[model samples]
Target: MIPRSISLAIILSILLQCARSSTLDDMTLMLSNMPEDGRLQFPELANKYGYKCDTYNVTTDDRYILTLYNIPGDTRRPVYLQHGFEDSADTFLLRTNTSLVAFLVEHGYDVWLGNMRGNKYSRAHESLLPDDLQFWEFSVHEAGTYDLPAMIDFVLKHTGQKQLQAIGHSEGTTVFFVMGAQRPEYNDKVKLVICLSPVAYLHHSSPPLFPLISLVGGPAASAALSVAAHGDLLKNSSVAVDLIKVACTQKLLSYEVCAEGVFFTAVGRDSEQFEPEFLPIAIGHYPCGSSVKTGAHFLQIAARKKFAQYDYGLAQNKLKYGSLEPPLYDLSKVKMKIALVVGKADTLTAPKDLQLLRKQLPDVVNYHVMDWEKWNHFDMVWGKYMYVFLFNHIHEMLTKYYV
Candidate 1:
């Protein structure tokens, strides 16, 4: 008869093999079923999780077609959530049900997540294909002046709500501030504006990648991206996305390295709270692509330290703004009730920069700093302790101001 110890060892080895095979099979199935365009079908995904999801398309004055994701609730207050740079509605949803959207939906708020032009969901145009150079020529200025207004108009019209809350993250906040200044009338449409990791004065931003971009200079980098993109600055899908989905999710290779790279751009203070498994999924949806001009605009913001229009040469600047230099955004014109939520460890939105912005705004209602010293930029969405530190205050303010 076989030794009992030997028999037990053999059984344990077989069980480990079976478990590994099961994990591999699951990862393979997921890869095959993932969207070809990398657009997360919120409705299908949300329905899988037992929630209702709806979508709408709004055409900007420039004819760029943008998409909006809606998760309806019985509450009367409509809340518009905008994603940051290279991010999508998925950024908020990436944390699963504990995400801000889920929390708001649970608590009875009409949640609408907007995607800017050139993102995965907003790559359509009325007269131009995605490949057209014209489609890739806009900057955040256009997004601020056109996309934000168009989405705002659509949301207010559809819900018949005179005023809704605006919550912006990173570049999301940039657009809101621009719109408020460029089109002051829209100010009345927002009941309150919450700026999360608010980025405007960015001269001091120290994101890991900023140094490389700054060294290249905005114009040179823009030119290089234009050449590489062949006019379609960032496609929704890419080889990198596919590779990560396979490698990290299956844990077949470099999963830890992959996780570190994913968070390197905008890190959280507490690395332990990051969901490694979700890294692959988040990577597939993010870096959704934007105009080369948008990238140049950010580099300009980082170098110049002021919120202004794109920096055309002196001659072009004169033609565009009647001045040799692009005029700074008139923040004093922003009359909305503004609240700034910043992270202590956020290098992307330095506290010093936010302080500068706070002084510029007309009606600054509340300026909140996350309680934790290590709460970095992305932690606002990814932090495990957010329910206690961040979301509670958000809920409180929303309740206090809801009309």
Candidate 2:
């Protein structure tokens, strides 16, 4: 019943998603993968650990394909590891071979690391082409609802487990919180959740970073980016990957990572001024489509006093689906015991945030902290010394939690 042009457009959209991925071969083909010194390069680190990277399609018919890392081991429980923004599963793999994913896998847990949208592994479902400006506008909610839930369901189905253990870092933690708050059903599905640098409060952001974002993130700032975008004056845009190589170092990239990090990283450190440290990005902007329109929904929690989901997005012709505030899932109401890990030096998520989560929970069976003086926002996964600092703590916690 659809017109020929309409049917063709639909088929083309399907084809666009299929073509969007930066396949394994592309990683191998590029000489410019992250520099060996960068902590986020998995192709090199995977080789170091002899671990393999595998790609999976998020949709059955193919709107998105999630790149996941599966290091083989003998664990019965599956730990779903989600990476932070402008990052991918490689963050864990590259930082430590005996890392969380591999550690959980070895200690009787099947470890699966997931890549979210805009990162190297999760570039799909953008309604626009790679060069189109529409591709770059994703916020936290889309990552929580569509990207994360898809990966979790895939892990549950693949592992044949009704419930799985979850671990999230930084924005990774925020997205997970949004997922739990917005989709309370997932709460029942996850056995335990470990939030690293939990960020319900961005007040901890380094001072210099906050003012910069407030400067550009509002409507006036957006208009500037739009006007400049129209003038084709975008910076370092030749290859988004190459831009990654530059931006991560330029300090501007920190703004790209988190809206709040803009303020958080710029203040409060000696050797580290809140500058965007260099790291790898997958390709280009991930088109969040209707997801951006739903921003007012997720912003309510931050606007209100605590963790809550505002609502979900709407489809073109379909009736509205997710609009209610994610049911008030009192952490005190959580049936299974949980563990909370925090980085004391993490300016983004100070001790207070985890304490807030701990205060709300019915059970806080275990608490851990990465108190190293050098640790910062992204260091939990991407720090040069992350393996030295974090691996043992993770080993200790998982052994306690799983056993």
Residue 48, candidate 2: alpha-carbon lDDT: 65
Candidate 1, 241: how far from true, in Å? 3.7
Worst 10 residues of 1 by lDDT: 1-10
lDDT of 2 by residue, 113-195 (tens): 77765555555552544345455445576677667788888888887778877788766777766666556677777777776
TM-scores vs. true structure, each candidate: 0.86, 0.66
lDDT of 1 by residue, 1-403 (tens): 2333443354354345444664656545746633332335556567666678888999999898999988888537889999888777777776557778878888888999999988878999999987777788888898999999999999888888888997888899999999998988999998898888987887677756466556634545656666676655555575433444444444433334444443543454356555554555565676677777787788787776668888876777898889988889899999999889998878778878888999999998999998788878877776666667888888887887788
- Model 2 superposed RMSD (Cα): 11.6
Indicate the worst ten consecutive residues by lDDT in candidate 2.
Answer: 282-291
User: CA lDDT of 299 in candidate 2?
Assistant: 34
* Alpha-carbon runs more than 4 Å astray in model 2: 1-44, 60-62, 96-98, 105-108, 126-137, 216-337, 384-389
Candidate achieving the largest lDDT? 1
* Top candidate, metric TM-score: 1
